[model samples]
Target: MDSHKILSLLGLALRGNHLAVGEEPVEAAARAKDARLLLLASDAADNTRRRTVHFSEAGQCLWLRLPFTKAELGRAVGRTSAALVAVTDIGLANAVANRLAQLDEDQYGEAAERLALKAKRAAERQSELRAHEKNVRTGKYRPKPRRTPEDSSPQVEKSPPDRRPRNQNRSRPRRGSPTRSPHPYAHSRPVKKGKGSFRKRED
Candidate 1:
């Protein structure tokens, strides 16, 4: 196996902040479902291996026993010693696994293939999300029509048409005639009943 190249890739991942070193961080990543792949040093203790297995199951990720020892893995990640590491990025995880698979097909081939498929799907989903967001910003997204209660309710029966003429129920004045005044004195005017004097007689 090209251990040097693997170590270089591990260092790159660390530098990119894609790696979670040590048990606590790895465990946190696994529990949060952020871990894509986990690497355990070949020299790790039995208990650590058991915990890595548990974490792999919890995170639904793959775990591999690296060919390098704890010290080598630690140096690659700038740590004193590291028995376990988690790769959170799918693309990086796939790259690292592919390299490992090239070195040892029996051990890493299946895992590399799985990570590749996962990375592809993740990329496709991200593209789809970006397209959807673009459509919304460009005013091309068509929202589904909303259904209201009135739409779903049964049609109401129409009221029967009036049998009488339209003007029969309404008292309307003739066009050129004036309407009756409500006030009794509205039409009262002074009259010259006694000669040149105009007087309003009391009714």
Candidate 2:
């Protein structure tokens, strides 16, 4: 089908059901899984192209690679760098499928074949990525063994002990008793002298 016809059909389909449009191929691919048809530009990136093709093949959805420029594709779908567009309706679904089938029989056959090949390659790449991710998650990719507490203990030399007593004078004074004097005069009282009573009568 012509690009204008495809665009009109897509608009009708979008009007009939909820449609999700994306500027990136990955988002478009995700939406395409539940969509009746997916639309992409001819100038999409290798990754985007592969993803779009994969979405179409894996989901059994009709796909169209428009010959318009990125800007034109964006204008057609009302976004910039629009790599993917989804149409979700039974009527539009059947129309897009029929249109794409007719295009595949005509001038678009070579492009469709190339998309199929790219989709196959993308599928293989996805499988490899998943395998690598699983290995990493399961710790199969790591080679070094983890360290344990036994591997980190330190070795120390033994030392000899001293024999000296801890306290030389261990006796403790009673709570109410007088403390022992350190000198002879520490507790002594002063002596006093007085004259006899007969000496006082002379005054």
TM-score of each: 0.73, 0.41
Off by over 4 Å in 1: 154-203
Tens digits of lDDT, candidate 2, 82-114: 767766543454555455556556755544455
Best by TM-score: 1
- The residue-by-residue lDDT of candidate 1 on 20-91, one tens digit each, is 999999999999999999999999999999999999999999999999899999999998999999999999
Give all candidates' CA lDDT scores.
Answer: 0.93, 0.64
lDDT of 1 at 29: 98
Query: What's model 1's lDDT at 132?
Result: 99
Q: List residue ranges in candidate 2 displaced over 4 A.
A: 23-33, 97-104, 107-203
Which 10-residue span in candidate 1 carries the lowest summed lDDT?
A: 190-199
Q: On a 0 to 100 scale, what is the lDDT of residue 9 in model 1?
A: 83
